[model samples]
Target: MADKAPSGRILVVDDEASLREVLTIMLQREGYDVETAADGATAQALLRESDFDLIISDIKMPKITGLELLRFVREHAPETMMIMITAFSTSEDAVEAMKLGAFDYITKPFRNDEIRLIVRNALERRALRQENQTLRQELSQRYSFANMVGKSEPMQQVYELISKVAPSKANVLVTGESGTGKELVAKAIHFNSPRRDHPFVPVNCGAIPETLLESELFGHEKGAFTGASGQKAGLFEVANSGTIFLDEIGELPASMQVKLLRVLQEREFRRVGGTKDLPVDVRLIAATNKDLATETKEGRFREDLYYRLNVIHIPLPPLRERSEDIPLLINHFYQSHAGHDVKISDAALRLLLDYPWPGNIRELHNVLERCLVLGSAESIGVDCLPPQVRDAAAGTLLHDLPEDGLDLDAYLAAIERELLLKALERSNNVRTRAAELLKMSFRSIRYRLAKFGLDVDE
Candidate 1:
């Protein structure tokens, strides 16, 4: 027999003392920790005191019946599994117990092996359920809004829009430059919404061949196409009761756009070459770097479809526009990369900030990851930065010195102070925003301000 410590605990409830003793002894011998209760009332009290993995109760009991106990367990201990004990005369009641969510039932005078096997199956089922629940929680955390790192006003507004629209059944359009974390925002909305327990399906409309795109979205019956061998469920049907994120929606063919519009209008779609209209309940989220309104006006996209998808619009700011958020994002990526002992010099960080990130947050993340893997020094200096960053940093500060020479430290400090003051003025003395504007972390900017005795509130 396997170890009882790993199998989990069980509760046996019956009015008959001998039957309770027999079941407890049998379960314990089968490598399960066992407890006994004389009646449903005792079982309920025990349940309130301590948790059990499985509950075995008699259908007819004094004070509280087994059906009532099932209700209590369902309401209070939903994670626990329940089984019923009944006689041949009350076998019909056991079927009713099954409808009430009983895991299984064992008749009186049943063989010892039969009862033991039933109990084992119920425990196994409970363990599987608990495992799945834990995985779902981990996935939810991975895609939560906390993973989208930024505190800029632009990001704050984005957060507010997401929170407000996530709970609604409206379609959303996310517009931004490529690599602006549009997919991340889509995942955050899906995981935070009511449909989180269901699937969150994503498909890049541009990646799939135009010939196969229709079948991919709506699926097809066997023999529907040249290579079709089996009936298949489409992304929309797979995402029923959840979310479907269509990336690069602007790249969709005009015919597919019309089909998508029909689905949005009627909440139903016919598969490629299939006659039956299949209904779907899905929260649609579309993303594209293209100016969709312009696309609609130019006849490249359907105007009605564009309006249907643009019901809730979220535009992500380019990284250069949110430069103040760079340092925070760097630190976030550093911690994520497990670079506990690594640090980047302020000079090096400034170089990163000065460069216009055409690729946005995604590019920054990739660069940081590269540094963590390739850079050897504990303190990452300007020399350790990528060639483009280093060259840009050096070229920006190149200048001739006067014959008398210059106070380099004081000269740089004065430039720093002026820039800080301007950033502060622009951000209305919000230190966090000022830090973002200067491409420094909140803590780093605060330290510099305090050193200069310029940490004044407006």
Candidate 2:
């Protein structure tokens, strides 16, 4: 078999020409690209010219010492790994070099095996660090505001609110209907905040049984309860210095609400069966599809706790209200799931836009994925959609009217504007052709366009 290509680049720095040559030859034999530097200054020059995965240097050298070179590497290329070599009599210098960011150290009378093992371990650590850094960057980009997929005014407002609130320590309460992406908003805030490096713990208040709620939030000591098994940390303790997202906060029982409020006010809590209070510093982000304010009035939720969690409020608009964003969201999900090769027919796109998405973005994504997977490989047509989506009628819109009621005039106007826009899109923006598509006379279409502030000569 052919020899494997060099896996890592190594720079060997020593004042002794013989030692440098020996170390270089040994590393090169192990399938590493190796370079020799006669002194610390020469090593610095080589580092500027080329990148090295690992650096091995002699602690005792003239002009610039190994410790000095280590410091320089730390400030200039902190990601690069370094190892130091020192005489047994001057081992303390090796210890100092370690403090100065050297990866590891070896004594002068060391075996080649010892050098090889330490060098391999240091290179492995460097590779792991690089991998972790890359993953963090990808996650940051994935949750960024630019990736949220909306250009409507309502979504723009949401993006602005999240940006302003992410840097603060204030608690946030996100209100929206089911499938409106409340958890997504929570993640965007946490990832953009200073606590991005720490854990992002999510707890579903509705999912966990009431009996285990307290212990889950405040952990339990051994024998605290039947299934205690051993001592364990709670979600709050686990989320220290980061973020804890509480979904369906409205579902939290009355008893747990009091304890949660205390934690919010005191910043400390004792374990289920322990005495000492454990201090926790975490940002709280709560989400609920229910009207918490109304729940408080109806005596179902505590008003004080509601105020505490509502320090900052973010209300997400339902998909029907932001219908203009549907096409953008569809394109985003399509590109993400099916790539550019699969296409969605214009007729299918129109039905998707007309359908009242009561399940919101989540439902849209699932439908698109299903179509791409089960439908034709080349295109997603009307037949690819579920019956509910394909047969969606104008009456379905009335079924989702808010409990508080809506302005009939404003609601009808929105529908009319949307239909007009769709017609214009289908007709390639020609007003006369758009009127024909909508089955309206040119005069009527022109008057309606002027009324909606969308008047144009063409």
Best by TM-score: 2
1-458: candidate 2 lDDT, tens digit per residue: 95343279999999999998889888888889899998999999998998999999998899999999999999998999999989874678888888888888888877898988888888889989999999888887888776898999999999999999999999999999999999999999998999999999999999999999999999999999888899999999999999999999999999999999999999999899998998999999999999999999999999999999999999999998898898788778777765754566655666776678999988988898888787765677665677677556334465877686655654465457668867887887899999999888999999988765566656
Q: What is the alpha-carbon lDDT of model 1 when measured against the actual structure? A: 0.85
Residue-pair clashes, model 1 = 2
lDDT of 1 by residue, 5-80 (tens): 3487899888999998988888888788899988888888899999999999999898899999999999999999
lDDT of 2: 0.87
Whole-model lDDT values for every prediction: 0.85, 0.87
Candidate 1 clashes between residue pairs 3 or more apart in a chain or in different chains: 324-436, 324-437
- Maximum-lDDT candidate: 2
List where candidate 2 sits over 4 angstroms from the true fold.
Answer: 1-6, 394-458
Pairs of residues at least 3 apart in sequence or in different chains that clash in candidate 2: none
Off by over 4 Å in 1: 1-6, 339-342, 376-384, 398-458
Model 1 root mean square deviation, Cα atoms: 10.7
